[model samples]
Target: MNINDIKMVGIDQNTPIEIRERVSFGKEIKKALLKFKETYNAEVVILSTCHRSEIYVYSENIALKTIKDFFIEYFKVTEDELGQYLYILTGVDAVKHIFRVACGLESMVVGEDQILGQVKNAISISQENFASGKILNKLFRDAITLGKKVRTETGIKDLALSISYIAVKFISDEFKDLNDKKAFVIGTGEMGQIAIKNLISKGTKVYVSNRTHSKAVDLKKIIPEIEVVPYDDKYVQIARSDIVISATDAPHYTIDYEKFIKVYKGKKICMVDIALPRDIDPKIGEIEGVSIYTLDDLKKTADENKKKRIGFINVIEKIIESAVNNFVNWFKTLAIEPQIKNINKFADVISEIEFERVINKLSNIDERDKKNIEIALKRVAKKMSDLMIKHIKNDIINKKYEEVAIDFIDENGGNI
Candidate 1:
């Protein structure tokens, strides 16, 4: 019944990109959950995104060592490597962290809307795999509700500063105008779509490419002006474009330095890599005419956007507090319900035994008198049960239900 039994272990934007990339589970989330459960016998939910990887667990006994071992083996990280990057949170802090994450307060791009869906998706995947229990299910459901509440109630989401949007903004700031810019976007995922939209909005001619050509073609259908370049010819488009935004979930680098350097025609280009495993090679930034920006580089604009929305942060915090308090209160009730049931059962058992003893002792009395005596005794027992339950309910409201229930049960009889 201790709320502190809930625990979370993971890393976020605070860690270096190299560590983040290594720790990130990406598409292997379901497999990871199964491994975690099989290894630790605990209910778990994992949230992995471009900027963060988090695991939430509910268990009777949490073994940090076991959890750490799972991460070490799964991510192929050494014990020391895991220790440096992993952050552990427990009890109410774990709950608060989840709510904050769902609200996008913990994002690199603060108030970004993508994380909310990511959080929901994490819980959904956990549920689909039966890796979530009552505690995690309730926690995630409330967190999602709180996320929606924060967005609808505040202006925090007014100018949503997503990674994709930040990349485009970074590019926009560098150039006087994007009207004449030829931009090539790699990968047609969510981030790619967002980048394309922002680029098109700024009147830039966009060339889109994805590993799956159909996806790029689909994006072209949405924005008729965009040209869907074949995946193989992406470098040719990259060589020609003034701006490049790469946001793909590819395991390896989509744009390699060796190949790109060979194809370079000395045209100055601004490149932004927004993918997790990183879509572009770091060495490409060394090229004379190429200025490459990774997700870390987008922090400057993200920070500026964060500063603009700092005033509304207090409002969101209050909303999260209220939501968390509500969830904790409900969880407390869940903890106390079992004790309440036990108390009621004890009352019934005691009442029946006492009534039987009195009736047996007065066996010589008339049948009518016996009936009257039994009715009176039953009333007294019912009143006593009602009073005890009233006190228990009061203790629950005051958040002293556990301590008070223990004392009451001990005072009555250890058996109860």
Candidate 2:
């Protein structure tokens, strides 16, 4: 198999929020992957989150244009807009990118733990849709393994630098004391859960709300002091709270600017939106007496946290490099084993043909002598074939036999 056959294309936090928001995939990610399979006949896995939307494809004959076209159609973006935002990676670069992403090295907040679970969920979804084949299955599994190893082996994740945690830190920096502040949290997803936990730890009273009220109730059970507001009453609770953080998986805006303008009193309020499609409308930020922070806005705090932990980066990078090399070596071995077997089979076939020719010419020889000669010839052939096979295997492992191996297969009619 060719290592360069794997490809990844996507937009991430590095892209402007305007473009990232335009290209972000949400619940329709599965439909998008299925469309890619139907259109390009490619095996794919999609990883879509608030910070990134990436598709990893494993196919023998797929072009960068084909992958880019899928995104242009899916995201409804023009070629110029897509070209400015899209990034393409192939082969070992693709593998290394995945490993780094899983390890949280590529996250907006370095050492954030949420990305690992997001990646695993993406892999599981791909498996359920049969969009993942042999190569992707192995690739994703190895990435997860490296993610776990990096976390355990390095000091990267010692501090809580997640976006949620950073949002709370931003709030704390603004209001020197949160002991008496009331905060409202929307959505009980991973980010919401972390935000609620951090808020409570800061001595802030928290109220939670979700489209599914049951999840809000469940969250309340974890922190009994926290109040659970019904989905419809989110606006009323928002008016009462000092801090409001909205992070839902809704496809559209949960908080309309016009609606918020009516309910929002002329009191100072801090709003933190950590959703991709944006739970709170951007227009809401324009209103007087209200301050809004999106995932992009939290980068300042993320950058500060990253600088403090910059020393551990080299250590984690070394770990990722070692893991990536091991995975590549294993893949190389798998690719070469079939050729090695075919070579040995060809040697056996030639030995048998020559042995038959000699036996036919020795018709006067006795049966016992003929059997003894056959045994000796077989031993000689086995030794010579074994030595040649060993040398070829070593050359392949050292990556020095590609041309010769291809020539051998071509000369033998592509078979033993």
Candidate 3:
């Protein structure tokens, strides 16, 4: 397939969290991948994270509108609901977008390292479901390599900024110091763990909880100083804490408005919900003496990080550009290889026919002479095949006869 067949349609940090939440695959991502595969018969990879819900596909016939329609039907949302939030990218633009995303250049917290792993996980999930094919597999593999290269060659990840780090940093801004504060963190996943560790680094008395008690116990084992609260008893610990951060992959809200109100003591508290589906209900933000933050709120800290690290952005962009070019060059060969093979096959056929016609007239020739003539004809065919391939490649690189070169190959050689 051509590079233009590589397409991506989704919403990112630009979309409001309310709308973003509606489109997130969340725990249903694998199911979504299977559905896309069944419906469109395309290579699909869904990258659903706290900041984005991107569906990437590689197919020759699936139109952008088809994916848009599938998104609307599957998510059960109308065009009005999506409302200018979705982005559509294809060809080189799609390649550049993914590379940027993997390198953390497109993240809300620019150059945040977590997105690299998230991208890897998205592709891994797609592979596990058997939804990804050669094109998407190679695209994602290149993206991951570029991600690692950017981090290694540049100082983009030097600050080690992440959504979790920024969420805690937001709260840290409100308080003079975290050393005297107690934090109750829900979920022990990557984001949850990052939040917990960042809080501990600030010398905050951290109480961790997870739906799986063993995970929370494991976390506490890693940091013996931190306290572990039972998942059901989280509300008790949350009430006692000055700060509460919920960052779980649960589909439903972990701290809904109804349940949180029961344990509400009217004491001033700050809650941060960093999960994509959102662990804390938005309505809880309306409570008296309560302040809540979601992924959107971290934009402020992200902006500050961007300003401090603006210089690294240029370096990152150069690296992304180089990576994009390399991937595109490799991708071009997918389309060209079949044409080259056809030309070589055509050459072989022509050489055999001409050799037979001439050999018939040279019946008196020795077996050695026949063999030498056969070798000469084969060498001539190989030379002609190599010459045509070189010219076609040059034309593709120049973009001068790229369209016509394929047509030429199709007409002169493909059928033969």
lDDT of 1 at 381: 69
Across 108-168, the per-residue lDDT of candidate 3 in tens digits comes to 6677667888899999999999999998999999999999988887766654457888888
Candidate 1 deviant stretches above 4 angstroms: 161-308, 340-394, 397-416
Query: Cα deviation in Å at residue 33, candidate 1?
Result: 1.3
Report the C-alpha lDDT of model 1 over 267-288, residue by residue, as the tens digit: 8899999999998999989888
Q: For model 1, state the Cα shift of residue 313 in Å.
A: 0.7
lDDT of 2 at 219: 68
TM-score of 1: 0.58
TM-score of each: 0.58, 0.57, 0.59
Write out the backbone clash pairs for model 2: none
Model 3: residue 393 alpha-carbon error in angstroms: 2.1
Question: Quick one: RMSD of model 1?
Answer: 12.9
